[model samples]
Target: MTSFEELGLSAATLKAIAELGYEEPTPIQARTIRRMLDGADVIAQAQTGTGKTAAFALPIIERLDTRSHHPQALVLTPTRELAVQVAEAFQAYGKYHQIAILPVYGGQPIERQLRALSRGVQVVVGTPGRLLDHIRRGTLALDQVRTVVLDEADEMLDMGFIEDIEAILQETPSERQTALFSATMPQPIVDLARRYLRDPERIIVQTEQMTVPQIRQVYYEVGGRDKFEVLARVLDYESPSSAIIFCRTKSEVDALGQRLTARAFPAETLHGDMTQVQRDRVMARFRSGQAELLVATDVAARGLDVEHVSHVINYDIPLDPEIYVHRIGRTGRAGRSGTAITLVTPRERRLLKLIERSTGAPIQRLRVPTIADVIARRRESFKETLRETIAAGGLEPYVSIAEDLGEEYSPTDLAAAAFKLLLGEPPEDAEDLLAEQEPDTTEEEGGRRPRRRREQSFGPERGMTRLYLDVGRNDGVRPADIVGAIANEANIPGRAVGAIELFEHFSFVEVPSNLAERVVRALKRTTIRGRPIAPSLARPRRATGGARSGERR
Candidate 1:
């Protein structure tokens, strides 16, 4: 809870921090900034969205010799995207000071970088490969560099840039201060730190695991194709006063934002590709309530400080558990209750569990809001508006028209007609919302069950129903596949799938009776290892109360 000023930052840096609306330094920033300011070689383990960028950037910028046009500090990141992000952070924090920061990365014109290098920047943020390219060309000078930062060191190792990092470190002054920040310290990262850093102070920030308890975390297990529709359904059901939908990529942000706008959701998108002016405008609209929903990628959504955000929807789960924590942290701020909803695929169940363990909180499973649910919510909203209008007594002008209409028709009839008009066509049938699954039929085919055999029936267990799936052991199916498919498709928890009895060519899996139809419909449109499946209600067999052992192949 330390402020930047309290961390002994310069007045100019503190001003820039205030402008950015950051009042208190995050735990990582508080701990890392002081250590860096003291000129200590530090290795910090902190996740993205923990203010780690500012943690390193602020201290580096603070110590920059602005008079010298040479690069005083260098930051090595894992990707071009991260390089740009770090550079932007440095620029923002150093706006008042006469400091120049440049981001050099691949996919961008080398000439541009060369020109910037010639003009001389105080700091350079770049990826290893691109930085190494600059080093080879003698375009980027390292002799004057006094401090070096390896941001996301583990990620760099994962990308096979450890050797490049070593070469870069070797090129810098031996007396230069080094700081390495990573979410996890694998053995390779530890070894790199030991070799490069001298008597480094290890600082581990564990703030991400403590997400606000006021936030109601929930997730909808769903498929890729159905994600957007489910998002719309949840939005409709919740009717959040203000919401932010987090997507994983720029394309996803733009696509989802466009679709939401097309559906009249009052949304705007923010991504790294957007120009600064465009980003400002989008954020302005979002903060001013001109837009209700802001759809953005994680990088774009960073540093978002809005108090009225009532909901955060993970249109796509983040790559890391800590990023999930950061995304949800956007809401439930300013002592207000907020809802954080994630759309998790079945294959991603283990990841969700990891997030739960990391945050020390369980995310509840949420069913996709049905058509009926959406309709009821809309109706309630309209009714509330009507009641408020009546309470405000603003209908004095409309009373005359109402009286005239009432004279022509009974008051109840007129009110009913008005309500029908407000409701608007009753949200087309739920079956129409998606492909229809065949309904359960009790009628016998050939005076017996269609797929009946001598197999003992487990029947329905309490509030659960048995479903017969066509693909089983013969099709290379496993219990996990069935659980994953059903949980992901029907947007239910895998644990909610009751039991499984695998047979040679078919299998019977038990799912909550309430979700049986949804599970059926979801499974119908998908396949397990390229083999399509048909799920139907298992017919009853002659009473046998003993345990019905599964017929595994």
Candidate 2:
């Protein structure tokens, strides 16, 4: 409701924001920025896409003393990805200030981070796990830190970093200004605030009042490998008037869009990576109906309220629940029921539960459409096209052509041929039109698949190292709980992790030999599944449960 300049932001910060083409301050920004500039400690209730990063980043950069190189601000995030994103925002807005910001997180080589720390920077944004490591190494100095932000505080709590967060807060100067933003203010978070923060201002941003009623919502639990296949079926069977598929990241949007187009779907992509002119061209075709399918990232799709959107397919489940609400709400506008289908990978079941709980809407599980269903839908569409033509009675001009074909071929054969022509199948490949169904692939018949960037194999095998976890299945810990924590903590890709065996008393997981040491150190510093993970190179000398020789039962 307020203008950006009215929030007391520096001229350079305002200039950069204006150049980004934003004028009005979002509800969260309007309330939070004014208080932050007023030197108030604040706790804000806002989601990922609600412009919280800018609300904090703008004020942090505005108050930055560019002449002083030491980090005056510390922004702690839940994930490395978020740290990178927030750091980028600081660097962008501070270009005019000539201020430098650095992001430190695990998985990234620490030497580089230490070097950056050695050459002091103006702002430091990092994850607690890695930030703690830096602090322990005596490379980062926060004695002079003026502003500290705990971004995504609830996520940090969920990630079991509450203790580390508290310790990090203790390390910063007590006089330092603190700003906290989270969607949910759980008891643990409130307790954290009460313990450390001065009387902080509170700002809340609620969901938008209106929704696109025309869009129908449906969800299906799926795996990562099967999403593309399912999405192809949705497009093939539904044949939306013009569809826009939303992905969470620019990389995903490009990859998914390219994959769909390679399979002969008339699709194009739009994302932050694209130039403004390229975006203009893609939208021009979409608005004019030439581009039947558009794959876009969330940044590219913001403010898109297209009336003719028949279906909005979420190929990659968004990380945030509100983003899900926004993605599906893209369709079913103007009082017409449109279809919104989301594909959730098994690992993202956590996100599914959160969305259902937050939106207060039941996410009906949908069954995957089989090949037969796809064919049925395609035939039904073809029949409607034929029937509509017949009812309109405008085919008299084509009667001669049909009569001539009927003389050489039976009416059934001619009709089948006509169906093939209408659907854009080649004449030679069209014989026996209703051929047995086989899974369609991105590979063209007789053509090679695009050579994917060969992910340097970790090799056919590698040394295996084991760790002793204090708890297992009995402690509400699953393989994923172990994997997500380590994958996030060690900065290891989930796919890189190997065998896991859990038992009543403890669990042991095999990780790549090279990262075994760091993984052990990280696990030792944190708890897994609410129980401390006492990881050591040597396995637990004694058996605690019924288990196999190599794995815990």
Candidate 3:
């Protein structure tokens, strides 16, 4: 029931919090802010997504002296992403005050940090290594720092940055207020706190039950390569208004973002490699609903507090059980129902089991949505739109057109044709749908049958056209490689790709005639075996004696 007003925050701080739509203080914020403002060293045990950033940031901003140009507060985070996030939070909370904040971290040019430091920032949020580097380079002075916060202390210890942390702290004023926040009180963290903090106020925020009753947790078992296709199907079936898809690595986030965009999903990516401006733009797009999906790594998503996310998808299952909980907790907020989905590959099932055991919440298993399911969902959505449109009474023009069309066809036939047009043409072959289906058995169990071959002399199979690429066996290209490239780049079903023929210096692939041009365009934007490829429609050739040795169906 505690509000920011009752917490004794200044009007400016309260205004910023109100603008940010925070009506009440979270338990951690309520307990820690006052202690921090009173210049007390505090050690708070809290997890991510519990408003911990605001707990420290609000006090830091309120207590800062705008007249001083030197850094008064130093926040050390475990990762560059967290540093940026924390720095941004400080900026947001301190917007009304004329305080300069700089986030110094690795992966960014040190020259930028040097320039900012030279300009005299009042607050510096940085990773331990980068902060230590600045200290060693004589570009940063923490002698006058009034407050120092070690954020995610356990994470820093786990990442083996304890020495860097110790070295950085030694450069700071011994009289400075020090606060250490960690999710768990590991012995090392306890020892570090005892070594530095002087009778710090220990505050623990008890997290909600791990069952996350408001969240409907489920997972799909899928192959690593087919994850994208399965995700597309799931997105169509779920039709989530907003979603965050978590990947394990920056590369995975980038790749998945591109794939989702290529498939016509409005998606943005957040990762550690992105610059601050780029990260800001991405977050802007996502928060404004211009982008429906945000593909991100765990580190980059730290301190993200969007409340409207309808779903949280683990594109790659987290290796740690606590991380799994943190990822899904982004959704199902404020007592609102949400869905949490995870995609588990065969080898990752053991890790998934560990998460279930750790959280004491059983994630229901789901079959990867089928093409039929996607189509059915689309039809239902279309019908809803139709009903709403009819209820709105704006169908006169369309009704006139339908009447004219009725002269040529029955009403039911006309409706069917219109629905077909809305849904687009069905896949030419049922194989296209089957390709996305979850395998009933593992490959080791011989779930797959040998592909049937059509002689190269006969050219591509019916309704298929052949395309040529400039690289082949010489480029170490394999059939699977070709299929993966075309299917992923073009956002087409794998079965839509026909036979692939690998010659010494070139290769030929068959795709649906309808999709030939699109495949060519997509291939132009992709590379194979680290070599760029120029794909074009293949010219007719004389009948060959038989299938070539390297040909694969």
Q: Give the alpha-carbon lDDT of every model.
A: 0.77, 0.73, 0.79
TM-scores, one per candidate: 0.49, 0.56, 0.49
Candidate 1 vs candidate 2: which has greater TM-score? 2
Candidate rank order under lDDT: 3, 1, 2
Over 1-553, each residue of candidate 1 has an lDDT whose tens digit, in order, gives 5777889999999876664446578888888999999999999997665678888888898898888999999999998867866786787788899799999999888999999999999999999999999999999889999999999898899999999999999999999999999989999999998888999999987764555456899988765545665676687689888899987667778767755643346788887789999999989888888788898877677788999999999887764455677778898888999999998765466567757766778899967766556656878888899899889886788889899998789999989988877543442344553333211122221222222111112345678877777676779999999889988888998888877877556677888867776887798789997898866555443121112344532
- Over 1-553, each residue of candidate 3 has an lDDT whose tens digit, in order, gives 8889987889988866554435578789999999998999999998765678888999999888899889999999998767866787787688788799999988888988889999899999999888888898999999989999999999999999998999988999999999999989999999999999998999998876455445899998766555666686688789888899998667778767754653346778998789999999989878888788899887788889998999999988764455677789899887788999998766566567757765778999987666566667878898999999889997787888998988999999998898877655655554654554343324222244322111111234778888777677878888899999999999999988888878656678889988887998899899999987767656444221122345555
Put down candidate 2 lDDT per residue, 323-343, tens digits, no spaces. Answer: 677778777777777888887
lDDT, candidate 3, residue 87? 80
Query: What is the clash count for each candidate, in the order shown?
Result: 0, 7, 0
* Residue 224 shift from truth in candidate 3, angstroms: 24
How much lDDT does candidate 1 score? 0.77
Could you give me the TM-score of model 3 versus the true structure? 0.49
What's the lDDT for residue 249 in model 2?
60
Candidate 2 minimal-lDDT segment of 10 residues: 450-459
Model 2 lDDT, residue 373, Cα: 63
- The global Cα lDDT (0 to 1) of model 3 is 0.79
